[model samples]
Target: MLHDLGGLLFIALGLVLVAAGFVWQGGALRPLSTKRAQAAAMRDRSRNLLRSADMAIAEARRRAARDEPAIVTVEDVTRVACRHYGHLFVEREEAAAALRQRYEAADCRVDCMTDAFN
Candidate 1:
């Protein structure tokens, strides 16, 4: 009876592992949350991204005021975002894009952080 129980336990564990493998391979075991919940979560994520972008931009402005290095490199902007809001949600490209738009809107020719990358 003990041997039979052990065999059954092994079989159960194997099935669990197989299911996990399928899920890992994109077997559509995605979070079964409501659409409204997913939308709200996406909105929150966007808000966090915006806030991080704003914080990074503000840091760039402070650095400008200091007249230290006139050059706001991508690394500098990324570091500022990571310092305040962590790096997971901070997209350097997106932040740079926003900065370019804002700067150009005011007819300014300031070199952007992404210019170094280009």
Candidate 2:
């Protein structure tokens, strides 16, 4: 499933780039810029975090049927997602200057910590 998703992402990205090249004056293919690659990696990591949460929640649900105390709530999955994805954005609030810049560019808030996503 992961491999298929990755292949799709690359194919979509390739199609977009081709369209962009033709729309612009020159139809030349170029390597992704450092910032573009980093952004893509960040999104992929975020997606992976969500996927992990989905799997965890599903497992918890399966267990919940047999055990009453093992119920998985949205908070549980969201916290898991936030913690994992937050680390990718900024491991430390005070020191993640680059990440903060990216967030600002995207017009979104990315405060350091799991609370942002949660």
Measured by lDDT, the strongest candidate is: 1
What total of clashing residue pairs does each candidate reach?
0, 0
Q: What's the lDDT for all of these models?
A: 0.58, 0.50
Error of 2 at 97 (Å): 20
Summarize candidate 2's per-residue lDDT along 3-99 as a digit string, tens digits.
9999999999999998887889674489679999999987776565445445444555466544253343444444555565554332333223333
Least lDDT summed over 10 consecutive residues: which range in candidate 2? Answer: 109-118
Task: Give the alpha carbon lDDT tens digit for every residue of 2-101 in model 1.
Answer: 9999999999999999999887886556676798798997677555545554555556666664434334454555565567656555566765654455
Cα RMSD, model 2: 18.0
**Model 2 error, position 68 (Å):** 1.0
What are the models' TM-scores? 0.41, 0.37
Runs of candidate 1 with Cα error greater than 4 angstroms are: 1-33, 65-118
